[model samples]
Every structure is written in structure tokens, then in C-alpha cells.
Target chain A: MSELTVELAGVRFGYGAAPILDGVDLTLGAGEFSVLAGANGSGKSTLLKLLVGLLRPNAGTVRVLGGSPTDPDIRRHVGYAPQGLRMATSLPVSVTEVVAAGLAPSKGMLRRLDRKDWTRVTEAIEAVGLGDLSAECLFELSGGQQQRAILARALVGHPRLLLLDEPTTGIDQRLRPALVRELRHRADDGATVIAVSHDPDEFHEVCERILVLVDGRLQRITHEEFHHQFHEHGAPG
Target chain B: MSRLFIDFAIQAYLAGAAVGIAAPLIGCFLVQRRLSLIGDATGHLAFAGVAIGVAVGVAPIWGALLTALVGAVALEWLRAKGRLAGDVSLALIFYLGLALGLVVLSAHGGLTASSTGVLFGSIFTITWLDVWTIALLCALVVGAVALFYKELVAVALDEETARASGLPVDSLNVLLVVLTALLVAAGMRVVGLLLVAALLVIPVAAGARLAHSFRSAMLWAIAAGLTSTLAGLVVALLQGTIAPGGTIVLAAATVFAVAAVVGRRAARRHPRSSAA
Candidate 1:
């Protein structure tokens, strides 16, 4: 078996009285690109949050990188780009500064950024093709450009795993392909990637495996199965 | 000018300047986060502190500062729990503090006259002790912002992302609330509880419309704040009867209105510039 990057066994979680995820058993291996497909409120975001240690499961274990979800060391090796990008866009922050925030976890409170940090930030910005707009304020960028900048933030630290929650929500249709292509390129460079998406078409070409969340239940599927199920249901307008 | 008039003007300017500088310095973040009402809540809490201190014949400033800080921390904790909305939590805590203060004051037999000073500040009664306290608090607030500028900015812009990036998002958030409490406490003596929120929000809101960067927004907000306080103090002094707090708030509101108009016109002229 391939080395396990994430392993969740019978994990259950809920917000208040409502149960969102129940008995979710899943595993992701090293060097794998997996797409999580689910309808709204199917616990996709909750599951991602659980994996990243943002939330704790009520029952069972959630292990990422051979440690508990709350392990700081494991979290250091994983990067998460949340679905809520509105907060970053509304603030008067520059693209470069946003990307540089990804470097925050590794540095101490008083630690100053050195030349090496700048190099990493520049490389990450260039990777997302936002080098030209690095100095531009984030609120000034197009939605797709902003999404790319967020993606660059996730990739800057060269994390062992990347977890993106609904990354293409507000992205422009024309730029979708390029963004997916860039993500695929990063995965090709040997980083384990797990992305949650509502649209099967957007991730079909890039993902090697598919996991579907239906009413909080997780079901593993092949690419063909995902395409058949998703296409059969038709797209949401 | 007579020596007495000059002394009064200098004192008003000094006191107003201290609050003017501190309020918008903290307000920039508060306005951006849509937590402007929090300043109002903290200001009311400071009133409660002042009431309690007056009942005991202790220094009202100490009581006000401690209460405001505690209230600020409570507000943060409630928000973090995800149980209550920010504004609702603030309102609930604010009323509770006020009720407690009222009870404490009444229990000590009829309201203390000193409580009125907190309700509507007396700039003409400016004391050296109050000036020293405001100066010390201002230094602390400014120093904290300067030292943690980058980390604070990162968390304020996107807290979840900041946490993911490894920033101490929670601690930074708590620190921000503490600093805001300190600002409110310092301003309470100069602007009064009811008018203190104006100093915390109006200048920052106006500056936000004009400035293109976070740093610029803060700088502009500080400049607007200082200018309005100074101008308001002069106007109040000339009138000889108007309250300094009311004049300062009016001045800030006028600046905010002007900024809004200018910002809208500029945006229309430069359609491509994302001037947020």
C-alpha cells in the first residue's frame, strides 16, 4: 500500500445539534491528487476542516501525516486554502503580502523575514503567473487573479499536502482551465492534493481519484464512476 | 490672548490630541472588520467602570480602564465560540455592564455626580493626572501596533488564512481587543462614553475611502483624527459653552461626509482604480 497521507476512521462530527458528518472513513496516499465531490451541506467543508485540525471529530480518529489532526508538526507540513476568499479581497492587502502570509506558520512572532523568505514568495507569485501584479492591491485584482494569488499562498511553502476547499467558486470561466492546469502542475511535482468541488467537469482531467460525500456519508469512486454519476444528474445552473 | 485662555486652549489641545491620535489608530482595523459598534460597547463599559469607581471614592480612570479591558476580552471570547453574532454579543455585554454599574451606583445612595463626567467628558476640567494616563496608554497602543504590524495585518485581512500560514491568529486577535479597550478607556475621559465611538470609527471610515493601502489608510485616519480634534477643540473654546465631545464628534462626522463625496467622485472619474 502507498504511504498514507491522511487516514480517517469512523469520524463523526456535528455543529450544535445537527449531525453533519457521521462515520466517515477515508484515506489518501502520498503523491495522489484526489477530488472531493459533494452537494451543498454534505459535510465537505466540515470534513476538510477536520482533516486540517480546524475542527475536532466527536468520535473516531483523524490522522494527517501520521499524527492527530491537532498536531502542530503535522499542520506545519500541510497548507489549506479556505473557501472564504472574500475576506482577503475586501482588505487593502497587496498580492505579494497575501502570499507571504503563507510563510507565517513557520516563523516566530518576532521573527523577521530574510532574503530566503522573499525568494520563496517571489517564486510562488511567479508560479501562479501573478508576478506582474505582485505589487497590486488584492481588492484591485479580478476574481480569477485573486484566486490565483490565494493558490500561490497555498503553494509557497512547498507543503507536503495541499487542501483546497471550493477553490473555483467565484473564478471566471475562461481562467478556470489555466488555474486547474497550474494546480495539476504542482501535484505533478509530488505534492499530495485534495480539493473539494461541486462541479465534476472542473476537476475531471486533473484528479486521479474521486471521493463523493452524500448526506455526510463518504463513498470512494473511480474517475469513470464520478463522471457517470455527475453527468447523469446534470449540472446545477 | 489672556494667560488663562492660552492655558485652557493648550490643555484642551493636549487632551484632545491624545484621544484623537489613539482612536483612529485602533479604528482602522475596527472599521475594516465591521466591528465599529464594538467601540461603542467598550465605551459604555468604561462608563460602568467610572460609576463603580465614583461610588467607592477611588480614581474613576482606574475603574474605567479595568472594566473596559475585561469587557473587550469577553467580547472576543464570545465571538470565538461561534455562538453569538458580533454585534449582538457586544450589545448584550454592554447592557449587562451598564446594569451592574447602575446597581452599584444606586446601592451607594443616589447617583454620584462624578458619573456625569464619564457620561459627558469635561475638557475644561483637564487635569495633569489625566494627561499623563492618556499619554502612557497612547504610547503602549502605538508601540504594540508598530511591533506587530505585519502579523496583525495578516490576521485582520484573513484570519483563517493567517492561521493556516502559521500566524498566531488567536493571540493576535486577543491583543487587538486589549489595545482597543485601552484606546476606548483613554478616550472616555476626553470624548465621553456616548461620543467615543465616533472617534474610533468616523475617521477610519473616511480614510478607508481615500487610502489605497492598509498603511496609508491608518496614516490618513490618524491625520484626520488629530486634525478634527484640534479643530473641534478650537471651535468649542470659541463658543465657551459647548461640550468638547460633541464638537469633536461633529467635526469627525463632517470629515466623513466630505470624504464620502470626494471618494465617490474619484471612483466615478477613475473607473478602473479599485480604490477600496
Candidate 2:
């Protein structure tokens, strides 16, 4: 078997007494691209947050790259693109600046980004087809363009583990395939990729596995099984 | 205009210029973080500190600096502990500081000319020592911004992203507030405790509307700040009746108006290029 890049056992968590995720077990090996599906408030994003160490599980352990997700050393190899950008939209940060910031975590405090890091930033921008708008303020871009810029930020670091929440949000339909192709490329390059997406079928061909959150537990299903289940349920609302 | 170059006027100009340069430099982040009013809150707390300093016979600015620093830390602590929302914490500090300042000064023998000077700043009142102090603190603020520009911008842009990426989000937050406290205290002599936040926020607002990028926004903000301060001083000098703090804030507000108009026209001309 491929080396496990993520390991979670009997994880339980919630905002309050009522648990959102209970007795959840999941593990993903390197080079595996998995898509997580769930209804609204089914803890899909929360689970991704757990994997990124943004939230801690109330019970059980979450280990990524043989260490706790909260560990900075481990976090250095992780890239996360949340569903929606959580920044003040009014702030005049350019696409290039935002993508460059993706390198900030790995750079640590006080160390400046050298030329190599900037080259990586530029490459990521080019990869997302945003090279022309690199200097434009993020807020000035159309919704789809902004999403691509965020994707560029996530891709800039070239992390060994990439977690995305609704990564295709606001992306143009024509560009969706390319985005999925990029994810597959990252996974093929030995990165562990997990995406929490409402529409899992978009990733059907590239994803090796699909997991659905039902009543707070992960139900690992094959792509065909998910397709059948999805058809039967008329897809998650 | 000829009197503007005199030793006393030059000292005031230096002090005002320093505040101008430093306040907006730090204000760019604060504005981006939606903590623009933090300057006002800390300024009020610094006012209380100045009162305490006078009550105990210390230099008022030093007292303001110490109190503002402590207040800044306390505000962060309260927010982190989830005891109060950020705005509530700021409001609490704001009212408490002002009231405490009022009570302290009233009990200590009423509001004197010097204490009122702290309220409504006068450019001519600045000492060479005040100039040096403001310059030093301004220099420190500039150095900090220079050293941590990327980290600061990253944190301000998207705090969660910055944290998830491995930047020291919490420490950087503290540094921001600490630097804000320093700027508020340092600016009190030129713009006074009440109006210092104007220097901190208005210029950044104008700059953000006009500039296309964060770097450009910062540059524009500093330029606007300097313009407001220097112009306000000259106006106050010419008028001789108005306070420099009041004039400085008005000048900044004027700059904001022009930037808003220009930004609106530009956005109209290029709808796609305009910021949301």
C-alpha cells in the first residue's frame, strides 16, 4: 500500500454539546485524490478544518505526514484553499501579493521571500492562467477570476498535502476541467489531495475515492457506488 | 509662511510629519483588518494614561504610551478569551479611558491649559524633545513595517489563510495592536488623543480607494497623511485660532472626499477594473 499521508481514528468534534462529527474514521495515502460529499452543515468543511488543524477533534487523533496537523513542521507541507476567501474584500491586496503570501507560512516569521519564492509565485499565477491579472487587486477581479487567484495561492506552495473546500466555487464551467486536471496533476506528483465538494461527480474521473458524510460518519464509497447513490438520492441538496 | 521655518515651527513640523508618516503606515493594516477604530480606543486609553501620569508627576506622553500599550494587550486578551466581541472590547476601553481621564484631571485641579492642549493639539506647542520622541517612535514603526511588510499584509489580508499557512498569526496580531498603541500615543501631540485615529484611518481609506495594490495603497496613504498633517499645520499657523488636531482631521477628511470622487469616476470609466 502507498504510505499513509493522513490518519484519523474515531474522531469526534462539534461546536457545542451536539456533535457534528462523531466516531469518524478516515485515512488517505499519498497520491490519493478523494472528494468528500455532504449536505449543508454535515461537517464537510469542519472535517477539512480538522485536517488543516484549524479545529481540533474532541476525541481521537488526526495525524498528517506522521505528525499532528497543528504542528508547524507538518503544516509546512500542507496547502489549503477554503471555500470562500475570508479576507476583507475592501483591502487592496493584489493577486500576486496574495499568492506570494502562500509562501509566508513556509518562510516563517522575519525571513523574506527570496527570488526563488517569487518565481514560484509567478509560476503558480501562470498555472492558473492569471498571469495577466497578477498585478490587479483581488477585489477588482470577477468572482471566477478571484477564485482562480485563490487557487493559485494554494498551488504556489507546492505542498505535499492539499486540502480544498469547494475549490471550484465561482470558477467558470469551461475552466472546471482544467482545475480538476491540475488537482489530478498534483496528486499524481505524490501529493495527498482531499477536496470537500458538494458536487463530487465533477471530480469522478480524477478522484480515486469518494466519501460521504452521513450522520457525522464517513462512508467510503467507490465512484460507481457514489454515482448510483447520488442518482438514487437525487444528489445532496 | 516665513514663520513656518522658525526653530519652534520646524520642531512642530518634524513632530507632525513623523506622526503623519507612522500613523498611516500602521493604519494600512488596521484598516485592512477592520480595526480602524482601534486607534481611537487606544488613544482614549492613552488619554487616561496621560491623566495618570500627571497625577503621579510623570511625563504625560510616557504615561500615555505605557497605558496605551497595556490597553492594547488587554483588548487582545479579551478578544482571544472570547469574553467580549472586538468592538465591545474597544467600546469598553473607549468610554472607560475617557471617563477616567476626565475624572482624574478634574480631581487633580481641573483641566489646565496643558491638559487641554492634549485634547486639542497646537503645533506651536511642540518641544524639540517631543520632536525627537515622535521621530524615534515613528522610526521604530517604519522599521517594523519594513521588516514584516509581507507577514503583516498576509495576516491583514486573510488571517485564517495566514494561520493555516504557518505564519505566527497570534503574535503578529499582538504586534499590530502594540504598534497601533505606539502610533496612537506618538500621534497625540500633533493630532491629540481625540483626533489621532483620523490620521490612522482616513488616509488609508483614501489610499485604498485610489490605489490598485496593497503596496501602492500604503504609499498613497503615507502621502495623504503627510499632506493632511503639513497642510493642517500651515492652515493652523495662518489662522492662529484653530487647533492643529481639528484642522488635521478636516484636511484628511478633505483628502478622503477627493479620493472618493476620483475613485468613483475611475470605477465608472472602467467598471471591470473597479474594486468591489
Candidate 3:
């Protein structure tokens, strides 16, 4: 909890020519439960991607876990859940198969999961309340349940840092608190968590820190200030 | 059928069996990724490639492989750029391959009834070289899939998530297309260019209907592919006039129909989850 797990100095990035994150300097401490709130296309998701090493910075240095985010070894310790409902629902993949993929980078794709891996996968699934649906096909689950499946996938590897992009989008209203609690529990156990959300109210309930992405810069905002600003600007008049 | 008949068609039989396993195995990902038409698109390009080989006097399969690889590259380019939708790009290449094939076949003047077998597949003409080539190609596809199963599953399930997780998304995509080209090239022998897509797509479709898990679906797909190929070959041999490739496709279709019904019934019996 005392260690700096993420440090980005003068990081500049964009797609094609339109800049998204420009000269951004940021740092996150270990065991920090933080929410990144931003308008659509405000670089919130991009920041998470940059943290996970999915996008190489245009300029400046991005270090995750004291190594370049691009390093596979560094990324192996970073659990990331991307935004959007991208999982092909019609695809006949069981919940376990989805979670098992988190082990792929370490296990090398074709290797069968040993007992330990299976145990971790089961624990992760149960953590998200998907124990009963482990063998069920993805298309057989509701939208919220599917989101849990994706969460279980990210959690299966139990990385040192967790970066989730809108992890609550399709999640059930009832299960949302449990999901946050699980993440909170992980943070309490000394894992850094950085999550992106358009709606950060529920996230604020469990997270200790809240940062808003505005004008391509990370601005620290109090939990009360964030919800106030969100209502003022985000709500339709 | 006598043992002599079995012995004589052993090469074709072996090639067919390999297609039964390899085509559907690869097709599992292709179908899951919504790139199932890739087999047909590559097949069309293989058609043009084989025609060039036939007209130019090089090995037809080699020519098909070249064309298929070229098509795969084009597909990869289109996919990466996000410029053209997959099917549109495939359609563009499909027409080019089909038109080129027709022009080349007409200009070459070597297309007789037997030459028709080139497009329709003449398993009766399978050689030891053909069997070895198909076998070698199948082995590579299977081995690559086995070695990279997790990466492929990750990418296919969700490319962006897999990329974010540090999987080599671009290289894996290239690997997928290259493998598709190779399978299409090899599949041209047993099912011919016209019906090669059938073995690659239909089995996976049927498998999806029957299997609840990804592994089960792929296993079921292999079963469907193997049985259809075997039955089709046997029926085509017995019938004497039916095309082997077309007959195999029909057999796969029948299997898909049966699987759909059985799978639907099985699913109803469980009613396990409320997935939308």
C-alpha cells in the first residue's frame, strides 16, 4: 500500500492526430481504490489502456510496476477488464473458459489448467457469484451476469493491480455493491485498483480516492465534489 | 465395397479424414470470431490460384496456396485498417478470384470433364503426394492451434481485452489468417475450391448447436466434419455421378439440421440460465 505501482510522466498519446492524453503526469499508490470519471472520449479508457501497456505513449515515460507497460511480465501482474460488451454472446464458451483465459499469458495457451489454476478460477468465479453458472454458455447468461463473467476473468489471475473500464455497465443493480465490495476487499488485501466509470457514485461508496479525467489531465476531486460536478454537467436539462 | 476399393482410395480417404479434423478445428475460431466466411473467401482465391497453376503449368495446389495467402494478406490488411467490413472485403476478393478463374479456365482450353474435378475436387485422383501434403498441412494447423490455444481463444473471445491483457494481438491475427489460407489451400484437394468452405463452416455451425462449452463445440465440430466427410465419400463412390465435394457439403447440412433439433431440445430440458 505504501509503494508507487504506477507512474506516468509527460505522457502524450492520441489516435491518428487527435490527442487524447497529453503531457499527463500521474501516479497511483499500491492498495489504492480509485475511480477515474470522465465524459465519453475524455481519455478515461485511454488512461486505463496506457496503464495496462496496451497503448504505447507518443512521448514521455510510462512505468507500471517499475517496468514499461509493454513488458509482458509486468502486464501479467496487471488484471484489466476492458469497457463495453465486447464478448461475442453467441459464442459457446463456458464461464470457466472465459476465466481460464486470464491464465493464458502465464500458461501459454494450450496447457491444461492444473489443480491450482482451477482452484483460483473457481475462487474468482465464486467471488463474483458465478459459481452456479461456471459451466453454462455465455449466451445463456443475462447481460449483468455476463459482465460478472468478464470480471471473474480479470480477477482470475489475481494480479497486483486491477484496471477496470466501466466494469459496472451491464451489471445487475443488486450485484453491483457485491462487486464493489469484492474489489474493496482486494484493495484491503493490498492490491491497487483503478477503475473507469461514467457513473462514479456507487464506485465512490467503496473507493478511497476519486480522480476525474478532464482536458486530457488527471484532476484529483473529492468524492462529494465529483458527484456534485457529475450531476451539474452530465444530467440532461 | 471390396478391400481393393478401400486400398485404392486410401489416399483420398486419409486426406478426407484430415479435412474432417483440421477444417472444423480451425473453423471453431473462425465461427466464434464471426469470420466463418473466411473459408469460402479464401477458397475462391484458391480457385483463381489453382487456375493460374493449371494454366501456367506449375503445381495447381501451390498456385492455390499463393493466391490464398495473398487473399489472407488482403483480408488482414482490411481487418487491421477497419476500412472495409469483413464480408465486403471478402466479396471483393471472391469476385476477383471467381472471375479470374473463369477467364483462365476458358483461355487455357485444358478444362475437360476431369479438369472440372479441379474446381469440384477429384478425390479419386488423390496421390501419395497429395495425401502427404494435406497430412503435413493438417498437422501444422493442429499443432499451432494446440500451442497457441489460449491466445487464440482470448483474441477470438475479445480481441481488445486480450490485447489489453498483453497477448500479441496483431501477430495472433496474422497467424489466424495465415492458418486460414493454409487450410483453404489444403482443403481444395478433398472438397475442391467450390465447396471447401462447407467443411470449414458447417461443422462448426452444427457443433455450436450441440455443445455448451467451447471445447465441446470444437470436439462436436470435429465429429460432424469427420462423419460427413466419410459418409459423403462413401455415398459419392456408391452413387457414381454425384460430385464428392457437393455430396460432402449436403451431408454436413443434414448433420447441422439434426444437431440443431437435438441441441434445441437438450437446451430446453435444462432451462438453466436466463441469458439474453
TM-score of the second chain for every model: 0.93, 0.95, 0.94
lDDT of 1 by residue, B96-194 (tens): 777877888788763755566677777768787778888889888888888787687777777776665556677887898899889887887788877
DockQ, model 3, C-alpha based? 0.59
- Sorted on DockQ, best first, the list reads 2, 3, 1
**Candidate 2 runs further than 4 Å off:** B86-89, B273-276
lDDT of 2 by residue, B210-275 (tens): 988899999999999999999988888878778888988999999999999999999889765532
Q: Residue A54 in candidate 2 has what lDDT?
A: 92
Q: By TM-score, is 2 or 3 better?
A: 2
Q: What residue runs in model 1 are displaced by over 4 Å at the alpha carbon?
A: A1-3, A14-20, A88-93, A114-119, A132-141, A199-206, A214-217, A228-237, B1-5, B82-89, B99-114, B163-166, B273-276
Q: How do the predictions measure up, each by TM-score?
A: 0.87, 0.96, 0.90
With candidate 2 superimposed using the best TM-score fit, by how many Å does residue A2's alpha carbon deviate from the native? 3.0
Best by TM-score: 2
The per-model lDDT (C-alpha) reads: 0.79, 0.87, 0.84
Error of 1 at B38 (Å): 2.3
**Worst window of 10 by summed lDDT in candidate 3 chain A:** A228-237
Residue-wise C-alpha lDDT for candidate 3, range A162-226, written one tens digit per residue: 99988888887888899999999888888899988867778867887678877777778778786
Top-lDDT structure, candidate number = 2
